[model samples]
Each structure stands twice: as C-alpha cells, then as structure tokens.
Target: MSSSLIFTFIFTLCLLSSCFSSSASLHNATDENVTLRPQHEIQKLKLIREHLQKINKPTVKTIQDPKHGHWWLQFGSGTLVGYWPVSLFTHLMEHGNMVQFGGEIVNTKPGGSHTSTQMGSGHFAGEGFGKASYFRNLEMVDWDNTLIPTANLRVLADHPNCYDIRGGVNRVWGNYFYYGGPGKNSKCP
Candidate 1:
C-alpha cells in the first residue's frame, strides 16, 4: 500500500464505528419500500461529491426528497483517470448515502448494478442518470475494476476501511473494497 492508501484507511477507520451502529437494509426491511427518513448527511454527501469531482471530474447528480426526507447523489456515465472508473465509486456512494440517510445498504455483488433501492427499484432502472433508484454506477456494465491500472490510487483516495459486501467474507476483498462503502462487508476493520 502507498502512503496515501494507508492514510486513507486511517481516515475512514474513524467513521466505521458509527456507520454501522444499526443495520438498515438497502432493500425494504419489511415492505418493498425501504422507509426514508430525514438525514443530517447532506454535508457528508457533498464532501464525497466534491472529492470525486475535484479528482476525476465525472458527472454527478444530486437529489433531495423532503417528502421522503433523503438525499441521493450519484456519479457515473464516464471514466476517471482513464483507468479507474467512477462506477466503482458510485456503488460506495450509494451505500454512504444510505447510511447518511439512515438505512442499511443492500449487499449487491461487487460488480452488479445498483438497484433495489428504498423506492422499489434503483434510479438507473427508472429514467437515466440521476434517477436515484439503486443508481447504476457504470454506463458500461462489462467494465471491471481490473481495467483500472492501480486500484489503490483512485478507489483509495481517502478511504481505507472500505469493503465490498458481495465478496462473501470479511477482509479487504475485490477492487470494490477500496471504495469504502457503508455495508457490513465494506466496513473498515
């Protein structure tokens, strides 16, 4: 790991303890609609968006549902740094939004598309970018993290405790792991 990677792990490690204090499934807890509650995390989401935009300059979508009371911001439809794609970060953003908005993230596969959101299906399935359903992290589904030259650099920007929930076991697994999502599998140790 590089110095930056190590430093990032340390930063997110501080958030892990509080991120998973409760489990709020990305899918509905009981009904198909996962309840949405007011979140004090707009600042949190903004920080994430700012970091991605400043570093990669990918297109970002921001939405707030006061009726439902949540903020869903997603990034995708482009590449960042040629190797690392914004799609990878999109998944993590989805989870982070959930946690910030007071809900659990559904443990979708590392490369699976983001779907099964609180409002029935993810944003990707509805209209297009910014739909906010489980927003599809990638415009190109076939592309994998391997396409990125160094997973450590883009994915690990400032998050080290990240994990890929779909990886099955605990520990840093998969390139998605570097994204630092707020899922049980993605928590920092």
Candidate 2:
C-alpha cells in the first residue's frame, strides 16, 4: 500500500479504538452498580434532600448591578446552617435520566446576565458568567461519602466563611472535587 494510504488506515483504526473505549467506559459507568445501586442512589439523594428540611430557607437580600447584572447574594443576615459542603457532593440525577446533575447553572445565551433560582432543595441562584460543559454518566459525592456537608454555619459577610464561586465557563465548571475553595473566612482546615 502507498504510504499515504497506510497512514490514513492507521489513523482511522486509532480513532475507532478510542471511540470504542470511551463507549465501553460509559457503558460500565451506567450499569446501576457504578456509583450506588438503584436503591442506594435513591437513598443518598433522599438524604441530601432531607437536609433541606432543617434549613429555614432564609431569603437573604439580593443585590444586582444595573449595568452588568452582577448579582451579589447577601447571606449575612443570620447564622444559617445546612448540609452543603464547600466541596464535591452528590447531586442526584433526574428520574430516569442518563446524566447526573452538578452544581452548575449556565447562561447559554451570549451576554446573558441574570440570577435565577435553581430547581432543588435549597435556594440557589447565581449570575451567569459564560457557557457550560456537562459530563455524561458521572456522579457527584461529598467529603464523607454521604451527600451534602453538615454542620456548616456560614457567615457570608465575613468573606472567610463564604466562597467566591465561579463556573459555567469553558475551562472551569463545578466544585471540581474540592479544589475550589472554602472561602477566605471558612473554618475548613
């Protein structure tokens, strides 16, 4: 065979092999025995939701910049405690969905800037920075292997207790498995 033809054949083989490998990995990951079995996954998700029952759902005052739509959620009103660990935690998938949920709110619209509350247990809303990238057949977990973090009494004004979260971007996405921050005022060690 000509050298060019041989090179093309090798390249095609490599591409096909890589695609098969990726597909197999996805298959294995979704086998129900991957993260937690059906019952266990449900249990973990339920426990995470249960944490919200304890929260008072304090509606801290919100500030929005008129020009850029920069929103600042003020959480210094009181000592609100919950089970949200400032790290990776299990966000359950939608019923019968393939992709699991993470803590990412994206603004797909170009130049989109607005804060909207997410659909979940707690009151979570943030301003959009950029686009979002999602992973398939992945699960989010917490520090203790439970769901959310517990014993978290955050004082947002302290700056130490709060974390400056930024995501929905191309390069960066979500908690990134605890590499993000406990904020400047966080008591985490």
Candidate 3:
C-alpha cells in the first residue's frame, strides 16, 4: 500500500477505538452514579446501628412527624453532617422580630479528637412589613482554632404563615437531621 494510504488507515482505526472507549466510560459512569446513593444509605444505616450498639441505646427505626422545607444548614465531621429545616426558621420568623437560635453540643467521635462547635442566629422584620425579612448568621471554629463568624440576609414575600416545622438537633452531636421526605433515606451515619 502507498505510504499516505497506510497512514490514513492507521488514523481511522485509532479514531474508532477512541470513540468506543469514551462511550463505554460514559455508560459506566452513569451506572455508578445511580448506585452510589443507595449504597451510601445502606452504609449510613449500618453505622447508626453500630453506634446504637456501642451506646446501649434502643434502635428507633423511625421518626414520627418529620419536617419538610426548602432552606437548610448542615455541618459535620467525617460522614455525619448536621441539617436545619427551613420551616422552623419560618415559624420563628413569624412569631418574633429579633431571634437568636443556638444548639448545644451533645456528642463527639474519634475520642480525644477536638469537636468543632457551630452557632446560627437569625431575625425577621416586624409585622405589617407586609412581608418577612429574614437574616441568618453563622459562627464556627477555623483551622487555627480561631472563631470565625459570617452573616447573610434574605427577604421572602411569599412565605406561608401556617406551616409546621419539625425535626430537632440530634442529642448526640448537635447535628440537625431533617425528616418528612422519603422515609429514613435522608439520614446520616
């Protein structure tokens, strides 16, 4: 075969192989993505079981009257994170003008490891503002063990006045876990 023809044939083969490899990779990625959540949930459930065993606490398989909302705040160590429901914020906003919300630290893991503490505060505009003005403030310990604080404000004119807020900070680690969606699927280990 002519030199140019041979070169063209080799290039075409290479291009075809590259396309097939990319297609296979994409397919595998999609499959893995779908399976990851279920697997993680199972692992978290197992961890919860183990934790109960260690503490000699009864396994409460389910929570009653879970909370559902749009906004949230979460923080944790390792795989265990905290969450706060938006509904509670709304409820507090409705009843009071300047509100300070705080939680106590309850548990720590990896014994002897320093446990980080967090705090959140918020406020709302007074009645007849015709709407609620919301603001949130957060504080945490930095890597250098120094305290760092931040704040944010948001205004929502369409908040419903009569929605229920559920869920509370876990007594174990001050981590807030939300509920009322998808059974026990939204839990952390």
Question: Each model's RMSD to truth, in Å?
Answer: 18.7, 24.1, 26.4
The residue pairs that clash in candidate 2, if any, are 85-149, 89-141, 160-184, 160-185, 160-186, 161-185
lDDT of each: 0.27, 0.25, 0.25
Question: Candidate 1 lDDT, tens digit per residue, 31-60?
Answer: 567543324455334433343333331233
Error of 1 at 96 (Å): 33
Clashes of 3: 1
| lDDT (Cα, tens digit) per residue for candidate 2, span 4-116 | 10000002112323433422321222145553222343543343334323333222322322333332334334323232221221222111112222243233434343323
* Cα TM-score per model: 0.19, 0.18, 0.17
Give residue 127's error in model 1 in angstroms.
17
Clashes of each: 9, 6, 1
Q: Against the true structure, candidate 1 has what lDDT?
A: 0.27
TM-score of candidate 1 against the unseen true structure:
0.19
Task: Please list the residue runs of candidate 2 whose C-alpha ends up more than 4 Å from where it truly belongs after superposition.
Answer: 1-39, 63-71, 76-189
Report the C-alpha displacement of residue 89, candidate 1, in angstroms: 32
